[model samples]
Target: MGILTSPIPIQAIKTLCTNCGVRDLCLSIGLSNEDVERLASIVTQRVKIRKGAPLYHAGEPLRSLYAIRYGFFKTTITSEDGREQITGFQMAGEILGIDAISENRHACNALALEDSEVCPIHFPQLERLSHELPSLQSNFNKLLSREIVRDHEMLLLMGNLNADERFAAFLLNLSHRMLSRGYSPHAFVLRMSREDIGSYLGLRLETICRAIARLREMNIVRISGRAVEILNLDALRGLVAGCNRHRQS
Candidate 1:
């Protein structure tokens, strides 16, 4: 577990969404100035979690949905045999705990991959406010729909794509998401471990290593430990598309 770093003061954390450059990609999008101001009232003071700390555990009662102010997280589920499966990785500006909205309890554990800060939006208050604000309600619906689409895409990747193609699609998806958050599309650190990534991609760690090595050999990406620099995004996309064509055939 990584040590917790110094966190911003509560007062400073309160302005997170309002001052966030990526607010356009978050739930705050399409909100009026007044509504954005109102939003600040419902959000709890930013809470910091150390790497390896569970932000919320499976079966915990859902109190609020969390918005990542900064850093990264991995959500996982443990099976009856005690095997853990990585469900997803979340980055800054993304929402967590949406799955709990359906059953009123968290379905999986959300763990911090690095020192992180999150804004907890009181779910009941958010629901009440959304009733009066049609735009807010619409945005909330969109968020849920987006999650469904993402899940469907993941299923497609896992079921249809070969190992190399699965790895390529994974990198491309991460690049797109990071680019949307104003990060460089061609380079970034992989916050989660190779084992966690393997779990998420439904591959063994050895297979992941082989795929990465192959990509590097092809000069499609330059990887040093966890740092990745995509050298040929077009070639990577072609690999993904080619896999889809093979699947269709």
Candidate 2:
């Protein structure tokens, strides 16, 4: 049970997107200046979700696509036996709710890992605007494709990588994304907990803790609770490459 707060004004959301620091990484990336202004009109409102709150839940009718303006989220699916699998973690500038485009209903739950703000793009208007703006349409397709590729990578991690390799790759991927957002590549706070990391990586919580400890012992990374510092990025990359070689052989 998560709380949904009142939405910020539509005008506010538009202004935020227009001046957003990471607009290049968001849906507005390639739009012409005029089209970017047009986009401001289509983005409906800024919805605020408190920590531990769900932005949307499984089976909910899909009415909008949300772009994270600030904070983090984890999207998850629950099994028939009640096990929850984390499908993805989202940060600022990433799109959410795309999975529902086909079914018209959300297939998973998106929970805010921290207090967050998101700009909700009304789906109907977005579709209509896409028809008018070729760049917007192309970007939408790329976003969908990127999600598919991310899913494939997750499958690869689960199928081919050992626990240590999996963890290292996860950290590397996070670093890459953070770097793209202009954040420090070697150090950042882990927004999600060990259990959440374990769920996403298909490992037990104890196993995740052990892997983190092992990385620290190897001088590859230093983890103090939720803070992580990559001490030897090359070593982490080597570990990942070694795992890939094992998979290929």
Candidate 3:
């Protein structure tokens, strides 16, 4: 099959327009439109990240916060046993490395699951800017809070839900999120492989495959390689109704 290309048309970028898309997450969140443009001028051009490429790695100095413009990202943390525990996925318009604001090194490995583009907001420059600009501080603070909420949710999901339940809920969550972003809600590409998804959901690779097959058999999902079509969200969410029980063993 031919590669899928981005649909956005090429145009000359003025500072204002480039910051508009990621204002709430990467640039100035609550700043007036004019302030965002002032900040945008300092940012680098959009950088393409190929599939399986590392955007940043664990223990690397947190030189910048990356704002994903398109495609998917998976981050992981390696433990003492050398096992990588999947952290979370970063979608387009989301900020990466926000959690490392206080830390000098990145805590997780960030990898592109598909071809992607990210705009790097250099940390040293941003930190200085933040100290000088009230808008930058407010925006970064808001981003920090958002990251905390997301991480808290991930911790809760991992600590409480079983593999199958977590997988189902994750699919529902992804579908809903993409839909909210005006992307295809039912049909979309899976940027990550089954192994990556399984790791994130705390399931065996084979179990992930089996779960997808089960969803297909139940007419809830149609899966083809990395392409998935959610046939039924209501039924999928039903699989883990009120599954808030944390791991006790």
Candidate 4:
């Protein structure tokens, strides 16, 4: 695997550095002594990306694997028609760019939606580290598996989900993901723009706006520009669950 430059903070990547969002996830999962050292050696702080910054573009040579440190990123690929297909969103503690592991180039472009930081871990050194650390080998396997599943779900959503269905599902999934990361699932700002959300959900930008307004009318959510609050989470869940029945109808 070719290594690319990273944008994580140097301080946060230092071993014994307790500031990394993925520390608990990375450390607690499994790692060997040698693996830890090799991993640490290649770990470099990434350049901080402001909102709308390009972390890397499609067709760029893959140099390193990346882990999001803070904020959100939207990954997309351009089609033959030059249309953009939103592939996925990356959050803090989540790994991005699995395709580069084998492909040697970024298949999709990773873009920051807010001021964001990424940590680049050199892959060749990481391969050696994983060989020495059995737990790390297992950890790598699990991460790739999850990436496959996520891609499958994205494909399904893009092909089959309708406008309202897409909105409800996105809100439900986003809330659950944030809650897993110890963030306030209900009272969080949407760092991604409506257009990006539309791209991912395969809906029109106006449809995304209208859906958010409808949620507010139902008293299920409160939206003020990018800041969104799930005012009644139970009601929101009900709306999402209602999608299956609505689809059946």
Give all candidates' CA lDDT scores.
0.86, 0.88, 0.74, 0.74
Best by TM-score: 2
lDDT value for candidate 1? 0.86
What is the C-alpha local distance difference test score of candidate 3?
0.74
Which runs of model 3 end up more than 4 angstroms from their true locations? 1-13, 16-26, 131-136, 243-249
Error of 4 at 212 (Å): 1.3
Expressed as tens digits, the lDDT of each residue in 1-249 for candidate 4 is: 122345545444555334445665553255544445556667765646777888888998888887777778889999999999888888887777777767798898988888877777778877887777777788888888888888787776667666666687788888998898888999877888898898888778888888877778778888898887888888777766563323311
Model 2, range 184-204, lDDT digits (tens) per residue? 999999999999999999999
Q: What is the TM-score of each candidate against the true structure?
A: 0.92, 0.94, 0.82, 0.85
Task: Write down the RMSD of candidate 2 (Cα, Å).
Answer: 2.7
Q: What is the lDDT of residue 119 in candidate 4?
A: 71
The worst-scoring run of ten residues by lDDT in candidate 2 lies at: 240-249
The whole-model C-alpha lDDT of candidate 2 against the native structure comes to: 0.88
lDDT of 2 at 32: 74
Candidate 1: segments with Cα more than 4 A from true spot? 1-14, 243-249
Candidate 3, 17: how far from true, in Å?
4.2
Give the distance in Å from residue 104's predicted Cα in candidate 3 to where it truly belongs: 1.1
> What does candidate 1's lDDT look like per residue over 91-113, in tens digits?
98889999899899999999999
Model 4 error, position 13 (Å): 3.7
